[model samples]
Target: MKLDLTIPSLGPCHVDSPLKLSKQKGISTFNYSDDTQKILYDTSLKNFEACLAKGEAPLAFEKAGPREKIYFDPSKTKAAIVTCGGLCPGINNVIRGLVMGLYYRYGVNNTIGIKYGYEGFIPSFGHPFVELTPRNVADIHKSGGTILGSSRGKQNVSEVVDTLDRHNINILFAIGGDGTLRGVQAIVEEIERRGLKIAVAGIPKTIDNDINFIEKSFGFETAFTTANPIIRDAHNEAKGAYNGIAIVKLMGRDSGFIAVNAALSMPDVNFVIIPEMDFELEGENGLLAAIQRRLAKTKHALVVVAEGAGQFLFNNELGTDASGNIKYHDIGIFLKDKIVEHFKKQNMPATVKYIDPSYIIRSAPANASDSVFCGKLALNAVHGAMAGKTGFVVGRWNNQFIHLPIPVAVKERMKIDLQGELWWNVLEATGQPMEMKS
Candidate 1:
């Protein structure tokens, strides 16, 4: 699908940047980015050639960094930050980064934290906004979750915009996933309808790494890294007994990036199931039969499945969550029961162990890699908002940080390509069947 990469702006930039950096290229000099700088959306030569052949310009995103001039006045600007949706590893790091970047880098000291997602904006909720400064946020990065707190569900757009106006907020930094970004879009619409000049900037937050046009979201690396050792533990559990089996379920609602990467990180995984691929249960070529075959030869097996995998097996209707997300059936427990039943029918004694580490992995402190990445995302978001950019998200694309319009970023989630190298590598690592369908 074609994408529009244009970023909306509040107005022309007039105030010079507080960051003093040498414009010329030198050993110690730093360069500032301008609106003209762009990063290509597609890096593949085939797609680039195809676009040129069709006489269409390759889509590109505006590069994210400090500009020579900004729109918001440092001394008078008031900014607020809010986090919504599920917990991730790097939320605190992002919050601290924003506060430090605003106070130390841009000379903007007037900042406040919105408590409990968008609900904090509604007057009826009676939630108080926390005043943010460099001192309080200095040590928040050592922990997980947001200091500002978070919640699910959508708030009324009019009420949210009303809060921003009441607080005289000049800029807003929203941190969350697809649902949160959609909320940002609605708030932006409301702000424009009322002819408000508040700048809205989003920092895409999803442990699943499913945001579109973003190469990798913060906390994803830390999440998969945290899961690697858990897979090893499952492998050890399987090896401790005869015909032993271990089933591990990881986080992935519509995509299986964490499951795929965690399985690849450890080679002991014998079977990898994901939402993108379908598998049968009761045939000679099904997952149960495959597990039986593996146990027959190795006497032990490890299966890593994404939470959204094998959803077709369920016949009952599941309701949606507070955030309007479909409630998925627990695939880990389902597999455990089916495997034990199949073995009992065959008169074969087996030991089955099921592990779900979804919450634990997501709520841990950000690792070194994610901490640095969170800092970059937060700082870039501050830069964009200070320069009057609105209705855009700060993300990494093709190894360069760039600004992505909220509509474009939330258009569709990034899913695994079955024919792509990442999946191919997973298949090669696990030695699992190409298809588990009967």
Candidate 2:
């Protein structure tokens, strides 16, 4: 599928950037990013060859960084930041990064933090806005969760824009996942309809790392890292008793990155289940049969299942949540009961342990790697906004940060390619069958 990588802008940038860097061509010095700099959407040689053979320009995204020229004047620019959706490891790191980048890097001192997601924008919510500064946000990176707080739900677009206008906010840095980014798009449309020059920038903030086009979203590495030890502990738990089985339920709602990665990292995981693949609980080739076989061989087993996995087993509809996402049934608990019943029916003794570390992993502070990534994402977002870029989200693609339009970024979620090498590696690591269907 062809993607439109064009980024929308308020107008031409004219103000000079406050950051000083050498721009000499022959000298070895740091240079500002040119508007013409772009990163290819598809870097594969096969795709490049086919595009060249067809005489079509390959799709590309605008490289994200600081531009020599900016549109908003530092002294007059009033910036606002709001974090929405669920909590992740590095929300505070991102918030602090934005505040520091705006205050010190660009001399943009007028910054405010929205209290509770989009609800802060609605006056009736009665949420107070906090003034952001380098001093106040100095140690926020040391903590987990967003200091500004977060929520899941849609707010009125017109009312949100009205709040921005009332506060004379020129730049808005919205940090959230799919739902929050969609909200940002609506606010952008409202601003455009009213001919406002407010620049909206999104920082993808999902622990699932399901945002489209981004190679890795912030807080993902931290999540899997935090989950690594839990999987190992589960492995030990399984190995401790006779016919022991340990099930670890991780935080991948739509994608299985966390489950697969954590299982791969721990090696002792016998089965890795995700939303992308389907499996049955009964029959010869079903998960239960496989577990029985595993216990017969090793006398112990470990399973890692994503929260969104095995959702087809549920009969009653749980409906959607406040963010319009389907409320998934507890697959981990379901699998535990099914396994216990199946073993009992077979007249076999089994010890079962279920661990759900979703909240613990999500609320922990970001590790060293994710902390650095969050800071970079935040700074790049500020750079784009100051350069007049709007309706765009900052993401890293092919190891480089780039500007992605909100519409395109939220078009679809990034899922594990079951046919690709990652899944192959996962299968190799876990020694799980490619198909667990009857």
TM-score of each: 0.98, 0.99
Instruction: List model 1 lDDT by residue over 1-438, tens digit each.
Output: 477789999999999998987789777776899999989988899989999999988888999999989999999999999999999999999999999999999999999999999999999999999999999999999998889999999989999998899989999999999999999999999999999999999999999999998999999999999999999999999999999999999999999999999998898999999999988998989999999999999999999999998899999869999989999999899999999999999999999999999999999999999999999999999999999999999999889999999999999899999999999998899888898887
**Which portions of model 1 miss their true places by more than 4 Å?**
25-28
| Residue-level lDDT for 160 in candidate 2 | 95
Error of 2 at 373 (Å): 0.3
lDDT of 1 at 294: 95
Backbone clash pairs for candidate 2 read none
Each model's backbone clash number: 0, 0
Writing each residue's lDDT as its tens digit, candidate 2 over 1-438 gives 678888999999999999986777656676799779999988999999999999998888899999999999999999999999999999999999999999999999999999989999999999999999999999999999989999889998999999999989999999999999999999999999999999999999999999999999999999999999999999999999999999999999999999988887778899999999988888889999999999999999999999999899989989899999999999999999998999999999999999999999999999999999999999999999999999999999989999999999899999999999999999898888899987
Q: Weakest 10 consecutive residues, lDDT, candidate 1?
A: 21-30
State the lDDT at 63 in candidate 1.
Answer: 98
lDDT per model vs. reference = 0.94, 0.94
